[model samples]
Target chain A: MVTEQQDYAYNSKIEGEVVVSKADAVINWVRSHSVWPMPMGLACCAIELMGVGASKFDIARFGMEVMRFSPRQSDCMIVAGTVTYKMAQAVRRVYDQMAEPKWVVAMGACASTGGMYRSYATLQGVDRILPVDIYVSGCPPRPEALLDGMMRLQDKIKNEKSLYQMKKGREDPDHLPTGPR
Target chain B: MNFEEIFSELKRKEAKDCDSFICEGKDLVNTLEALKAKGYEMLIDLTAIDHGVEASPRFSTIYHLLSLGEKNYLRISVDCEAREEPVVPSVVEVFPAAEWHEREAFDMFGIKFENHPDMRRILMWDEYEHFPLRKDFPLAGIESEYPEQDVVERTDLKVKAAPMAGGPFVADTAGPMSQTEPMAKDQSWTESKPKKEA
Candidate 1:
């Protein structure tokens, strides 16, 4: 079969002919592979976030080394600590500015559900302000847990209706609530 | 001079606690001036305590002074005379650093520091209605919309009071001693009082 160029009846190699994939597959593949993260490192969990980016853990293996400070530049917002009532407005303002097709990773107990800080000053959870895609547990999760959450987020992205639907969902975010899933 | 010499110079009797001495509201400025001459250089901290709304001399403005030069400390306690609208003389003229401390005392205990350059609440915003540190204030905070009129105009940023959610919970008995010894213990509150289980 390898020697049969004239026969066309069948080599495993399709030399010069095009290979096809769904638009969903290609775009999601590209987007999932190169996720630019906005690190909202407000407290102790921020140390662990830095650890993920450091050489020992090497977040670059997933092609996510670029940590964008600006909300517009990043695709993922990793809220890594406590969200106080005073700070919720600022967080919402940044979330509003983040580009469409954005995803949020609520890292650690504090960012997810106020952890032990259930008080008047602390916002019970960040979901009070922004929609979260993944909730990674741990008081301050080890770097491995965050990486696993990232991969889970990637898996979620790969399964989306993709492209047009995501944009339409953003426009009518209320109607098509990107609620938990 | 040591605590004994300083007290003797000020014509004060020995306090039960040698480092601290009590003074009247009218004599606050005079005592502070005399202590400054005695070389207690810094007004380290000033705070006020509310004995009770009903108690005579309802507030006590406590000052912690340090002589950075002498390497010693002195505490001066002065009672605000009026029970209802307590006012104490400001010491900013003598210490300059007492400005913010006086503001903090006023903010927390409602003990007005008379002749303070700017008499406003230091911790709570200008429009905040309640003195949070008062005994009557609830453990769970009060709910209000934006504190500033300008902030209301700018955005619909609502800072809601934290929900109790059957929370500020009684001791989660399973947890270790470090976590749950002192739960939100009081039964009554001046604000949103927690409902009884029954």
Candidate 2:
């Protein structure tokens, strides 16, 4: 019976040495694939976000079905509706409370650009309040569109270099770029 | 009780609907109390309409009261004088549900509900300065003066012109050089001219 270390050595021989592989790549790979999303369902788009979590769309397939309501427990936030002026401050507070290396997906036209409610009460876009990693278009985008957006966020997380820097104590996770591009 | 009996008991002038009445602003609270005593238990809705800036008695707070047992409805229109601050007595004592509706009316039209226990902006944020539904308030929103300004007017924002004059269903009568007089007798559809041999 081969030991676990021997098995890793044998497997690494077929590719590259396991010890020589980039730690950032390994960590990012694991973090990107297992993003726990906080469902911030504000309005109509929330219904579609629910659809993606349900059996039909099965967001669990991508390992993001853990819908945490608390900001502290969530790794990503899916802002799923119109962020009105009344809700902007709350959205910001939630964003601030989320743990570091977090991502925000603005999921729908309203969350991305306040959709048709260009009025006194509605915030033009969630980006005005919180930093957004991905924007899913559509007036309440279909479940598939939300899944696609989540995948895009996963890709962004995979490409992030700051996570490695923070782990190495060379960068401040709290000061990570939370600003709009 | 029937609407007639209630009207006579309340001593309110019966309008055309026989259920609605234009109540004096000062007597609004008492009128609501009397109606509540007469079994108009549910305050269905409380809303205000802002007649344009030029209209007299610029605001009207309309209350829709329903009597479940009697199967009747009453509409009370209370005229709120146009001023820097418009005040109308709160009817929360008569019907507890008026709290939210009155707050909404206050939020939209700036109609002050005097003696409200916890009067504050319900729909808008606490810091929201303007009453949105007022005719004077800009429809899009006012530009913010805060340090982190939220509302930035988009230069690219364009409002599309109406597809047709008046609307799609209405005939275009305002176009330049358009005929305004009735058609000539020969132009009528019934008259037929001889077809030229081709």
Candidate 3:
């Protein structure tokens, strides 16, 4: 009977682990690359976020083209546009629903700092609600900027200590700050 | 019906702009009914104007009506007094489209649309205390505590300071084009030039 580990081991040998020498490194490499993004498009910046996934600046080049609308299926939340005060609750709910070891990318000046709308309705920044991992600054950032933000997130994921530490951080409330840090 | 016919029928004051009438709050629904009978089927827009704190009859609900059949447009203004709880007769009975518009007006200016089917806040959340668009409402917004954190306190430090006395657009010195001496010469050339035939 061929075990699951043996099957993967056989496949790894056949495929050749060129740079990913260790088991941990291979897992980290896969996790970093296969970051399924939850497109939380709120306003105008959503247009640029959509552009990043399009053919010209195809996000699939970095293996992040799988745009999942459901938070359960995604590992990253790309918050695109002005998160209004009215919509902040929904944003927090979506962020909370996302699976552990999740990352947030505040994609635009609006999502980062509410852009030029210093009005009553718009939320100041998304970071007040969710612990944002990356911030791409622009009124509405270009597709290239969004791609760069994704790559930065990938780098952060790559340098993560270990799966044990990540799981431990999720399980232990004391390990991580409860609210926005 | 044409603007003249509607004006004579409703006995409304002709607005400064052509094809517009200022209808009293009492005559609003009746005027809308008369206009609807005249084939003004589309409610183009419904908005309110804040006439400041001390102004009598503070809010004026502006309704733009369009007659697709006749390819004509009409603007109607209805005045409502600014009271602790200002009540205005809803035109929803005449036009079903006025439902959301009335709700929005209610949400922004705290104007109560009497007999509205669902008189709830349209734009702002239900829990939101103040009508944000009202003149009395602070431009920055009211202080409200969030479940996780105080949003006002968190954002206080992050708010960027406004530019110094003279903004970036303010010129330090007048350019040659901005100078009155050069502009006088250029004005004649622009004004004397014959209007281009469309």
Candidate 4:
């Protein structure tokens, strides 16, 4: 099984072609702006995540209203709760399902470090299974914080001319993710 | 243990090892038992943490131990170091109700008891990979199942079918008419979907 870090490091193999021109930047921008996220809520933070989607927070401003139920169609995965060892593999599989150029956002402390359940069951962070692009820090980050993280992600997207090309030197298909098999 | 007596005894013993009190996690289990021997048996609830931006030692478990006899309560706590394995002793043997409560602790916080008899996943399936209750556990949850039809359907139909038609009122559908149907035919009802006309 692919451990979380291995997915982001220098060894992940590139199975697809890289997008390497100015045009790629525009496409990436469109994709990033029109993000269709999968909100996989687990704990209390889920409530806040709902708030972000609620009329008050209105995540639709970022075009993430699709809130995909199937991982294959989502552009990014926003992990909003604690991830236990039992759930780690499943998270990885969902990450795998999303097509190329997919991103992951670790939304809260629990998604970042297993929050309060630092024991035998919970995985310290979702990063242990999937690559995280931006981290929104909070027990449950305020809706404003989530918006800021999205803006930062957009900034990151704007700067990159090619998502695949930027990821070039780090590709290694043969390398397996580093956690439990 | 009786809270009044324990408090008074604790004061007299001046247990130097015990200083300021902050109840937490599994420690509350032992503290409760020790208090119960003194007569404290009413447990209030479990409280937890979601340490964010505070720098490590992310979560804390709080247990409220109370006694109906003396009508007193004491708080106990255990700190789960960030990214560290948290383990505490079992109080299940002491309190029968603790069995389920401890399981909830395990299911949510991922805290493990030293000698839990059935130390398996309770809320998340055995195959499920995360302790969902932890503050840092991903919100998107683990990926394997997204509202699995079987699991969600079981409970959801009971709830959803109430307000509207096409609800999971399968038995209600056939009701008296189905009872008259042959026993072999009745077995088909167990299938989630209705049989298609050949």
Candidate 5:
């Protein structure tokens, strides 16, 4: 729920009127909720990622159920597998292609640090190539864990200073991360 | 999948009667030529084994052949007598499928297949130098660079070795048995440890 102010007093009325709030708060809330994820399922860990999207776990609650294959459409890159050396270039290219105000989630142990494969082929961590905002641990992280990560990302997005907020001469407040819930 | 059991069964039933034999490296082309003349017309698989980097005959090129008409199987083991850079004659001219197989073998074990049309690496990138399957190649890998980063070149995109931290292998031996067995104190391949300049 948005914080109440003099401009937002109409929202409290019966049959609630127009809500007024900072552009940062509104845009961040929208961006956080409807984070269309670019699913980069490279290995076995991707199975767990799929479970998050499916009805059993239901990623729809967080509004990230749209697993966009194309990088252009998606705002979040959930790299859900082992990033091998051969695939590193492709991953980087995809990350670069994605539109700005994008976030990356290194899902599962492999995507975080190569997991059991301490080998020549696998890239040590996806962060070695992509700028990761969140890292979900576990061999294949449970769907709940992924949801938790999504919420954490949402919290991060909520705290970020949007362009409109910056243009309004309002500097980003150095506030400790507050949970969206 | 149970090779020992299958081999034992084959041995009991006289495997030689099936016409599966291990041939020398020099005789590979001749053996394939003769096998093709017979009903064993298909080259099913071609792979290589690394004996050791130092051994006299360090590499062995293995070929599996199959015949639909005769319902027969032939496996040939061609031994190459060389320690470094073992060379085996490519059977691609006779069996077309051997081309990729030979390239894969070269890519993994550094075994050169003579007279193959394209002898470049089949799996790893063209610039990748290491024969990963070689005994000397470490599991944690070697530090290397990726030169193809053209999009956003902010930091130097290098392929760093995985931080093994020597877990499960290197244990804290100074502690009591109970403590030492459960947790590992890094001895080698640690992030905190100072890296040697290349």
Candidate 6:
């Protein structure tokens, strides 16, 4: 579908840049092309996760169709539910089990702050147990919102920081952001 | 019967601090039995709420009773202690729906339903440290991580029955931490030994 001139312009741009390391190129390509997500849907927010998979949203366009149920195989964990005290430890364990370079996205108000259902058993937010890289704020976010979060996570991956470094930066008590999400 | 009649009768019984025929908790059970004697069936949801600020009893239990034959609805409520675990008599034998509703209250409010078949963690995992729904508990997880020494000492955490609240939520049997075996576990960041400064 590319015209001859369009292809030439693309190649010239690539040639003008300094050569990228083979490993870095592969990693860049992989980060964008395939994002294996773990959809940890537990509450009403789970319905939004479903919307992201449906044809209207078509998350498959981003090549993130395969949702790994086992924590070990997943590239990132999307906490899409109301986490309770009973569920916090389990969430942390799953985050731990995920291989290096894993990401976590906290989806919805309930997962972020217990929402209106705040109660004795409801853990206020998931971030206490796992470091949340991106937060999709909504009572339950729209499908596009979830996609936006994933895209932001992709940007985080492009930086090439180890998962531990990224997590520690977020956890640093002194560096907490004062601005709104 | 009209609410006025019930209210007057409750007033006569000298139920202290009684207000406007709002029958709750133990009083609710007694009223339900009296209503059942008059042939009522079907108990609806059992729910509780936490008022968040300190009070003598910072919790309330709500019970809804229905009569299919007569087509009447009655609501009863009781104020009780917001203990780490509040104990209320189970109405499961009286109505099946109460089983799950009580469990839900326990799961969310940390209320304990006495005589319930099971009483354990419902909405949360087994190793979770604090009851989150309590007004005092932060909406977020507790500020500090589980201490390393605490994990080491918990080699004998017991496995209990599933919570009475009947729902899809289940405790991960293979929990994040093994209740029986702690020595073999890796030191998670929450419990990691502090780094040595140069």
Those runs of model 3 whose alpha carbons end farther than 4 Å from true positions after fitting are A1-24, A170-174, B1-16, B147-198
Candidate 3: residue A109 Cα off by (Å):
0.7
Better of 2 and 6 by TM-score: 2
TM-score of chain B of each: 0.73, 0.67, 0.68, 0.55, 0.72, 0.57
Model 3 residue B192 CA deviation (Å) reads: 55
Superposed on all Cα atoms, the candidates' RMSDs to the truth, in angstroms, are: 6.2, 12.4, 11.3, 23.2, 8.1, 14.0
lDDT of 4 by residue, B1-198 (tens): 434455432322223432325545434556566777866676576545546435466666655667678676555556665454567666667776666676778777777766878777576556555666666654434334423443232222111100111222233345586363222323342224544445
Model-by-model DockQ, in order: 0.23, 0.14, 0.15, 0.01, 0.36, 0.06
Off by over 4 Å in 5: A1-16, A164-181, B1-20, B36-44, B66-74, B93-96, B149-152, B163-187, B195-198
The candidates score, on chain A by TM-score, as follows 0.86, 0.85, 0.83, 0.77, 0.82, 0.77
Please, what are the lDDT tens digits per residue for candidate 1 over residues B44-103? 889988887677667888888988787887888887778766899999999999999999
**lDDT (Cα) of model 5:** 0.77
TM for every model, in the order presented, reads 0.72, 0.78, 0.79, 0.44, 0.77, 0.58
* Model with the higher lDDT, candidate 2 or 4: 2
Among incorrect, acceptable, medium and high, the docking class of model 2 is incorrect
In the range B1-198, model 3's lDDT, one tens digit per residue, is 556564554445656664777777787788789888889989988888778787887888889999999898888887886555677889999999999999999999888988889999998778767887878875656556543344433332232221111212232245663352211222222213532335
Clash number by candidate, in order: 0, 0, 0, 57, 0, 14
Which candidate number would show the highest DockQ if scored against the true structure? 5
Q: List, residue by residue over A62-149, the lDDT tens digit for candidate 5.
A: 8988989999999899999988888888988888778767899999888997766677788778876677899998778888999999
What is candidate 3's lDDT per residue for A95-149, written digit by digit as tens? Answer: 7788776889999988997666556677777887788999998768889899999
Which regions in candidate 2 have their CA more than 4 angstroms from the true location?
A1-20, A162-164, A167-174, B1-18, B146-198
Error of 5 at A43 (Å): 0.6
Error of 4 at B13 (Å): 24
The reply for model 4, stretches above 4 Å from the true place, is A1-21, A163-181, B1-198
**Model 5 chain B, poorest ten-residue lDDT window?**
B4-13
Q: Model 2 residue A122 lDDT?
A: 76
lDDT of all predictions, in order shown?
Answer: 0.78, 0.75, 0.76, 0.63, 0.77, 0.65
Tens-digit lDDT track of model 5 for B40-102: 799989888887767657788878888888787777777788767789999999999888899
- How far off is residue B31 in model 2, in Å? 1.7
RMSD of candidate 3 to true structure, Å: 11.3
DockQ pick, better of 2 and 6: 2
lDDT of 4 at A163: 47
